[model samples]
Target: MSDDAPVKADLDEIRGLLSVMPKADEAARDAARAREGQLTKPPGALGRLETLAEWVATWQGRTPPRIERPRVAVFAGNHGVAYKGVSAYPIAVTAQMVANFQAGGAAVNQLCAANDAELRVYEMALDHPTADFTDGPAMTEEECATAMAYGMMAVEEGIDILCLGEMGIGNSTSAAALAHALFGGKAQDWTGPGTGVTGSTMELKIQVVDEAVTRHLPEMTDSFDALRRLGGHELAAIAGAILAARVGRVPVILDGYACTAAASILYRADPHALDHCIVGHLSAEPSHRRLCEAIGKQPLLDFGMRLGEGSGAAVALGIVKSAVACHSGMATFAEAGVSDKD
Candidate 1:
């Protein structure tokens, strides 16, 4: 293993913790399915809800898994590359959108509220409203450490599930840069227009990301170093938050491309991180699809929605909740007096 790989001691410790994950009760699931079949509805009529419930039960380690009022945590920051004119919207929009979330006026706020989920916004320190490509990424080691501390603390705030969202202008550029450095991909492969940038603007976006990835190549030894070089403050925080959620044994819903990029970082840091993640939806960004495919996960939605702030994840949570309900509330063949065809 490389120096960046987890020490055997820590690996053993994390493995022990993982071993404690509650085993899914096959008996309870059978009973639950029996109940669902007996419900005043046709078998499997509920579609994915039936599978979702069982998955939730397995995740919660309970027969009747209840989410207990989930919450959304949105992390916001500015990417140094937004100054490169890669995105149509100005970097200032990140902070502006943060305020929008706080005011409960943004798309995420509404969707979360409608889904009965509380929203918390974190404004990580970063160089805001970037002017051009001259400025590099603003994620210093100190900033990453602070973000790690804050994100870990945030996950401790009594949540059954945590959804991660990011609001950083030029964040897509940062995501591509991180993807290239961490995943060994060409910048153009991961680069995409963010917030409706035009064709020429996207070309500039890819170029800036390529430059960032090239500059950081030698130092990109591991996930932390890659994040330190190319990650936005929000991305770092989200990565730490995902780690904390896994440690705390709570499911984490990924919001969009930006947060998915952060999730990739967490997975690289600890492969087990994927065990706790519930990919929310396929983002509108083309790169997001590639990233999801690489991670071996599927999005719940393909609605062509690219608005960050965890709106996509928030909508996806409804299905997650429904899944939990079905798994715990359904009836089996015996209960319904139906013959088993399986």
Candidate 2:
């Protein structure tokens, strides 16, 4: 049997899972909302926190949601496009940062430690960098499928909440290309100064994205095709992980631009894929705002974070925990002997 056969089968299985993925339980959401009204706080006083609690309940299919296990998975890959000078940092930074992640010295490590979340980093084949999409597809369809499957399997260990992150220099270029293809916009619109590229470097980055989009436009009709053409293994893995989390009915927290770009691919392929996702924060990257709007997710925090190591999501886990606490631990008006609105 050809190697492609197994890859196709795996991808088909993912499709089947997505098709059967359950929607958030509206009954549970309404129950949580009703309980919020009965909480000691005035109606709507808690603002988005109350809404977040209801969202958690709806996704968990319970009145009182619990976030017992939160996991953050960081997928690292090398992009051939980095050779085109899209990022100020060299591609070697991808591997070095992966080592830093494993060493528990990265910002994401510190944030995960502070939030009591487990961190898992997968270092994809950095030596075999993905093909530059400006010339051809970044990876074979089979390779993309395999990477995605790896991501899907990562969540099987069981998690109540999962956050997807990536570490690949010039990934923002790949992300911009994918976003441009999915959203039907000029490359400049989705392009941003990733890793602080500016002036000539930023202009070069935009040009590279435009060229890649033009080359891949013919095959951009399908979301997976666009992904394979313009996305790195890490991005593909993030999509797979998000899909898997949704299938398991575990809520996902999205980090920043690169992560959201991957989520956008899943969202475009299956709108239901994002049913269990909560945007962790708004990234400083300009395209991130548009990406969130495209996916219909309002970020939980807006701390101007643009780091791509799941730092935003790691920090936001505290907010998710708080939301769960309010939902499961807050005293109702009856218990508190507080008067409700007459």
Candidate topping lDDT = 2
TM-score of 2: 0.95
lDDT of 1 by residue, 1-342 (tens): 111322122212332433444434567566555556665456788887776665555455456768886989988777666666788988678778877887878998889878899898877654443223235435556555556556656686568888888888888888888777777778888987778877888788888888877777775666776776787667877877776776665778888888899888766765655766767888888889888887777887788888888999999998888777665555556666866655
Q: Give lDDT tens digits, candidate 2, residues 1-342.
A: 112324332555665676788888999999998888888887888788888888888887888888888899999988999998889889999889988998889999999888889999987777788998898999887788888887776686558888888999989999999999999889899999989999999999999999999989886668888888999989988998888787777888989999999888878888768878988999999999998988899898999889889999998889988878987898988998988778
Model 1 segments beyond 4 Å from truth? 1-47, 126-137, 332-342
In the order shown, the candidates' Cα RMSDs to the true structure are: 5.9, 2.7
For each candidate, the alpha-carbon lDDT, in order, equals: 0.72, 0.86
- Deviation in angstroms for 112 in model 1? 1.1
Q: For each of the candidates, give the backbone clash count.
A: 14, 0
* Span of ten consecutive residues with least summed lDDT in model 2: 1-10
The runs of at least 3 residues in candidate 2 whose Cα sits more than 4 Å from the true structure, single-residue gaps closed, are 1-9
Task: Assess every candidate by TM-score.
Answer: 0.83, 0.95
